[model samples]
Target: MLSRAARPALRAGAAASSRAAAPAATFATLREIEGRLKSIRNIEKITKTMKIVASTKLNRAQRAMTESRSYGETSNKVYQSAETKPLEGEGKKKLVVVCSSDKGLCGGVHSGLARFIRRRAATEGDNFDLVILGEKAKAQLSRTHAKNIVLNFSGVGKDVPTFTEAQSIVDQIVQLQGDYSEVEILYNKFINATSYEPTIIEGFSEEAFANSPNFAAFEVEEGVLPNLREYTLANSLYWALAEGHACEISARRNAMDNASKNAGEMISKYQILFNRTRQAVITGELVEIITGATASADM
Candidate 1:
């Protein structure tokens, strides 16, 4: 139906048109792949940076935890030797001081503490008051235990927790209006570099200490009892805070490391897919050109 020279040109034009449509879809897919790759690369960078930062802080946090733990143990030795236990005061509730942190991205550190509190409340009939030491726990517990939250402090565990911070927090806790029979400091205890669990250290009231079965064994001044209680409370809080900070840092480092590994795996997968799609597109174009040439030669 057409002249020979015209047929070749027409076939060439048809081939060009088909290629234009086909590669449009292929190119769109390629662009999407490129965008995803770029996004994943950026995420990997951010997670790597976070991991490095967490690793750097972990050493300091662990060192502080060791010192604080020793100090706390020494403070509690008197109560232990005195055989002091929490007294069940009439109409007095127990106080739970949760040592958490403001920053997140540290796998399950805050949530574990919150879950422990919820379980304790459920089992114990919600007879305890709460004092949260960080925004993360406050946010989590506020949803379920808002009424129980008597006091909360933010901007905690930003670095190695200092005695000043713990003392200030303990002072505020002591100032709380409730008649607390005993104080329990809840925190994440580091089991190892890769494992952690929620734990508690007890702080007894002066009255409880006075009534201990072995209290007669130690000689104390009349005014020193109250001071000792307060000092031990501060030391317990400092130990909890320092250990919890170390756990958070270690957890964050591990979480970021895992995230970066996952991102790398995804990038590798997408890159393979992108390359295959590109190769298919190039092959399709070549096939179209060959088919058109064959048809033109026959015409």
Candidate 2:
């Protein structure tokens, strides 16, 4: 099989085959890179869209939060003016209402509330019953403090919260009628566009409010106290929901913004690698062509 002249021709054919296979392999890699690039581009688009939506919602959420604050503040004055405090020395427990949302994608918005509760549980030694206002916190707190949950509500925090929603929640809370000394509404407080913290608003029981040291100054009727308590509960819940919504929107916008930035960085990096790889493939093809032409001329 080794006649000298035929051997050279066979070697040339084999070399051409090898060169063709190399280009095929390089093309396969190029296609893979292209697929990855497309996927990343799609993700970037989605994140950017989410950021825009959150930005739009942030303004409305802030407005709702601002409006609700007045209601809570005005209602709280009744207790503050009378110097009200939670009942003590009765072996009583407090009820904690955790205001979280059904939705996620905000940075630690739900987890922040959960963490706060866990910390309180650790320090307070489970002397409180939890009334979860959203599915998100319920799922989390249920794991460790499941026994402490007396009542939990769902289908909340989808949009800017309404007073009707707050009233409904307050109604359920009032109906619970547990032996709680006081109630606490917990929510994420909006510190700024980029910062938030867990905060609580204290709520006094009817007995506690009535027994205030300065209670005699107001001349309030016993019949009005029940209504006042319910109204105050509603007001506090509305405030918590609104402020938590604002915090969530702001955090989500920031999260999406960061995601988009990271995706852009990845896209830029991949683009450079793709361009270099493509140039390499072209150079390889040109080399193969030049080699073939030179071999033919030699023949």
Judged by TM-score, which candidate is best? 2
- For all candidates, the clash counts are 0, 0
In model 1, the Cα lDDT at residue 43 comes to: 99
111-157: candidate 2 lDDT, tens digit per residue: 99999999987886889899998899999999999999999989888
User: For candidate 1, what's the RMSD?
Assistant: 2.5
Q: Which regions of candidate 2 fall more than 4 Å away from where they truly are?
A: none
lDDT of 2 at 145: 94
| TM-score on alpha carbons, each prediction | 0.92, 0.94
* Positional deviation of residue 201's Cα in model 1 after best superposition, in angstroms: 0.3
